[model samples]
Target chain A: MRESRSDRIFYMVNNIFLFIILIIVLYPMIYIVSCSFSNPRSVTSGAVWLWPVEPTLLGYKTIFENKDILTGYTNSAYYTICGTTLAVILTVLAAYPLSRKDYALRNPIMLIFTFTMFFGGGLIPTYLLMSNLGLINTRAVMIIPGALSVYNVIVTRTYFQSTIPIELLEASQIDGCSDFTFFRKVALPLSKAIIAVIALFYAVGYWNSYFSALIYLHDREKYPLQLFLREILIQNTIDAEALSKGQMSIEDMAARQSLFELLKYSLIIVASIPVLCIYPFIQKYFVKGVMIGSLKG
Target chain B: MPDNKTYFYIKKWIDKNWQLTLMVILPLSFIILFHYVPMYGIQIAFKNYRAVDGIWGSKWVGFDHFIKFFKSYQFIRVTRNTIMLSLYSLIAGFPVPIILAIALNCCKNIKFKKTVQLVTYAPHFISVVVLMGMVIQILSPKYGLLNNLIKALGGEEVLFMAEGRYFRSIYVWSGIWQNMGFSAIIYISALSSVDPTLHEAAIVDGASRLKRVFYIDIPCIVPTIVILLILNLGSIMNVGFEKVLLLQNPTNTEYSEVISTLIYKQGLASAMPQYSYSTAIGIFNSLVNFFLIVGVNTIARKLGETSLW
Candidate 1:
């Protein structure tokens, strides 16, 4: 294709605009990383910019030393594992039955699920119900309440409908395969991509979740990483009085203050690691999940 | 008597599919217990709810809580704040992705496009707590990077989260920054599906690149845009409670107190949590969303083929 004068000018302008957008998005994230790695004084005095100055591991060292951070990490990991497993199973089960062409109650049942998506009983009643069911403050509350997403169920149902041909099911049935046997032998094996996508979706949700733990969990030991990060990250800066009443002198207090600031940047990266690491592996499926999930819409 | 054949078909269907029905039992029970039960529990909003007396045993107070909330000053404040913030977000946040998608669609460099998409979408994975923490630190009036830049430029440092005036802008824009890339995926895909032959024909007809984008590309993704806009408007009442709660100080509570956060505060944060009042507020919030989604879908159905229902 020949590049006309206007086309050339437009291309240059668009590329530059794209570059600016990139910087606008990336600068803060890079700055945070640089600050987290920098010396405490560099962070506290606003010296760090896009790159680390006097790089050190002190912030991360402190995070590792903190018993609460460790506990939160473990708890969050446990939640993610159990929650993702349960969510995938529930989604698959609910979605498969609804996806079956032979299922007579599919439309009404689908409405029953989707209606809940639009109107929930709000948080209070859900909390009350959780407490009444003896789920509040327990480990199960984190996984159970969020286990079956109607959105994922719909997405999975759409996947099964699109991918698995009805003839294959009929052939399996002719060979004396029952519905349960066919599902186990045929559908589950063929549905790996959607399963992976849904699992990744649920895992990320569980890992990044703090609100559920905020309202549900009581013990500090059971608090997720984000909640712990919230305590040190938000409360530390907001509650300066708590810092001053500590047994530290002026010099120690200043050092402690920088450490507090540095810890937040470190904790942000720490809390984000699970999702960021898994994101690349699941990037292909993630986009597919979104595409299929938007099928109805 | 005339439905004997239908009964036989029902019997056959049940006999053939009992195992399938068995497969649904676990998740069906979960939904009934967790979702339907809570929908039933919504009745507690009308009761003088006491934990000792239970939801069933509580004395009926009718619309006392709803009326009290309506009469209170916070009724106006939270509702206005919720609407304003959501509208501000809708106006500011909704268009960028469309624009970004257009830009991505035109970009000659695949590498740059992928890089931008990856980095920008990365923030969508970030938790609200952490995002709020970053927002606070970056917008801190004293030592924040933005303030430092402002001082470097001989400008006054702005107390963003602290000032009620700055709260909505900060909330809306940060939300855009977090979500725009992920949301743009739908549009980008839509744009990718746009026929290249149309662009080639426009180019042959001596159309400039900018003109081609407007004439050929923008018109192509209108359905996707409209449907997404409706979806966005549907959840207008359901703003980010975690971010608002995290960002709210005593000074900025007026601007930051959304319906969800208010419900959380009333229902759980206080020493004596007002369960019924909070439940009423929750129901009210859901009702607002219900109406908004329905209203938008109705208008959308009239205007276009794309409606949620």
Candidate 2:
């Protein structure tokens, strides 16, 4: 088919519009990276725009040296790994049985699970309950209270129902396979993709979460990276507040302030490094997970 | 004889499916412990809750807490803030992904399209703390990127984060920037499922790409759009609480103190936590959210076939 002149104009306009959006999205990411690497003085002066100006590793070096930051990083890593594993297991435990057509109480059990999605006990009650259970100010508080998400359960169940055939179950049963054996050997192995997706979801949630920590944790030792980040980045406390009280000379204060500014840019990059590193490998799985979830919707 | 027969049948069924029951037992226990138990504890909202007295032992205060909350000055401020922010987000953030998806769909250059998708989606994975950190850095008055840009352009520097008026735009637009690509994935998938033969047919009939988008693409994805819109409306009461809390400062608290943040403050962050009063506020928020979702779902069912249930 021959293209018309107007169609050419439309294509040109559409491409330009999308290109502008692309820049809008990409510029901040590029600027932050550039600023993180640039000399603190250059960054504070806004000389580092699209590229690094007088590049140095001082920002990253400072972040790595900070004891609080290191402790928080370790805590976040622990929570994410432990929490994700438990979440995935619990989600599968709920989702798989509910997926089975012959499960006697599937519908009622599903209703019980889904009801939580609509309403909850809210903050105070939940907090009180947590305190009563002796989970407050503990590492278990982060992992246990939020182990199973009903949304992920539904998504996994939908995946199991569609992908794992009932015929396979019946055939295995005739071969004298028990339900537990079938689940262990067949259902789990067959549902690895959905499991990966669910695990990723939980891992990200655990890694990014701070509200749980804020409410439950009191000891600074238990603080996650995000909580530490809250102090440094958002609250602008710690060194800045401490420095003011010590009566630093003008030049020294200005120099420390510039380094603080540069530190934030580097902190953002370092904090995001784990997710960004794993993202490329799992991006396809994340897309697949969303697609599976949308099918139920 | 009938009772005995039913018992025998139940025993046989249990024997056959006990393994399945075993699989669900732990998770079921988790739900009951974590979810339903807190719900039962909600009764403390009507009681004068004390740590010594416990939830059940506390003396009942009837409607006192509710009444106090209803009469409080913070009530209107928080509710208004919550609604305005959510509505602003919905109005501004909703259509952006659809536009992005459609634009991407129309682009024939696969490499450019893939690059756009990749870069745009990257920000969504950044922790909320990090994202907010970036926002504060970019909007800082002295030596910040935006202020620097303003200075370079011969405009006076502005404290973007400090001012209450700039809060909503900054929050909503940043949210859009972070989420638009990730949210567009669903619509992009929906667009992919569009029958290419329809586009072919439209083109053969002298329909241009833009015309095909309006006449075919939009219509095909309307159901997806409607479903998502219904879902969005259902959660209108929930302004992104964490982000609001992060963005909030002394100057902006008047505009930024939504119900969730208020609940956090009243319950946990205060010098003397008002457990009962905070619980009352929470219950009120939950009820509003519940009704909004149910009401939206019902309206969707009545108006279209895309109701959540």
Candidate 3:
């Protein structure tokens, strides 16, 4: 049937509205990329608008030369890798047993895990516990306390229950395959998609975390990239207050200030690149994870 | 005779399922150590905890810390700020994603829809620190994008971050920008599962696209919407602690201080940490959150079919 004029008008208007939203979302991202490439002076002078003005690599060069940023990058990488690995392993170990129908204590155990999601010991007690255990200001502070997530366990358990058949477990058991062998040889291999989803969730979480470090860590060398970014991007705004105190020459101040402005843009892009790079490849898995979670698990 | 029989049954169950028992041991220990241990340590809230005396040895000061928190001047400010910010975010941020999901569902062009989805979802992955960095850059009075636009339009530049009044709007809107796309995914999937025949039947009945969305699409997704709304209501006290802390400065502290940040400052960041008092404040916050979730869940169960439990 040929479309009515009113229906056509509706489609046209809807598309335009969506297009405006598209611009609203894309503009900041594009402007950030453009500002990162623009010359420091041009960036500070507001000459760069939608694209690079007198493009240069000085911002990235300055970032690369900063020792603190490099140390932070290495520390963040170490934390992400170790934390994700531990979290995935622990989540799977918890989820699989809870998924089994024959597991005698699944209900109470699951309740034990779920209760923590809504209520916790709060900050002071957790901190005191961490300190009492001698984890303060150590590398273990980054990984150990946050190894298992109850939400991920529930999601992964739901995946296992829906996708993995109990008949297969019964058959394997009849053939003398123990539960350990079945989990190692059969369940893990078949559940790669859910595993990938859980791993990505944990990896992104570990990469973006800074609060634990802020509260627990006192050493600069142990700081994550986010802590460093906080210092540079947010705390550095205080330097303007210092500038009014006349701590440096005017010319030197202006030059240093411009460089810091450009560096902020570059750092935002550089810091987000790791997650953004892998996002497209794993986007479907994330959608699947969310869908599985939304189900009444 | 009954005790012996019960013991025998327990032994047989453990023997038969010992592998499952072994699988849970490590994770169970982790939960006990990390989660349950801290809960046991919550007794510090009632004690005048000293490093030398330790948690157990400290003198009991029952309800003193909680009373102090209630009577303190900072209490009202932080509580009001927390509730206002959370309510503002919920009221403003909740509807955008539902509208976006509905709009995306209405569009028939596959390529345009896919592009919109991809670009919108990109910001959700950006970390909070970087997001605040971007916000600061865009809102800077000197040499910032908004400032530049204002100057070009013959308007005066405003210090967006420094001012107290702009804090809630900035926090809520930036949150909506970052999360709207990702949050819409669940609703999008819910819409996709909607029966096409419903729309076809509506079309046959002379319904417009807008009318079809109202009559068929929305009613089909109401359960999903209700479940999500319940979850959001349950988390009203959370208020995105890290982002708020990152955005807070001495100038904006009056508007920006929330319970979680206050807890951090008093317990960890202060020169002389007030461990017991901070713990008391934390307990109060958690109790409110717990009651809020339970109360909301109860209401939801009574009024609707979907409840978290």
**Which candidate number has the best TM-score?**
2
Provide the TM-score for each candidate, comma-separated. Answer: 0.94, 0.96, 0.95
Q: Write the per-residue lDDT of candidate 1 for residues B1-309, one digit (tens) a residue.
A: 579999999899898878777887788888989998888889989999998899999999999999999999999999999999999999999999999889988899889888888888888888888888888788877668898788888999888766788888889989988988888888888887889999889988999999999998999988888888898899999988878888888988878898989999999999999999999999999998999999999999998797777
- Report lDDT (Cα) of residue A140, candidate 1: 92
Put down candidate 3 lDDT per residue, A135-216, tens digits, no spaces.
9999999988888998899999998888889999999989999889999999999888888888988888889999999988
Give the residue spans of candidate 1 off by over 4 A. Answer: A237-251, B1-7
Ranking by TM-score: 2, 3, 1
Residue B125 deviation, candidate 1, in Å?
0.5
State the weakest 10-residue window (summed lDDT) of model 2 chain B.
B300-309
List DockQ for all candidates: 0.65, 0.73, 0.70
lDDT (10s digit) by residue, model 1, range A49-117: 779989997778777767778988999999999999989999899989889978777777788888888
Candidate 3 chain A: worst-modelled 10 consecutive residues by lDDT: A241-250
Tell me chain A's TM-score in each of the predictions: 0.91, 0.93, 0.91
Name the better of 1 and 2 by DockQ: 2
- Give the per-residue Cα lDDT of candidate 3 at B55: 86
User: Candidate 1 at residue B85, lDDT?
Assistant: 92
Q: Which stretches of candidate 2 lie over 4 Å from their true place?
A: A240-251, B1-4
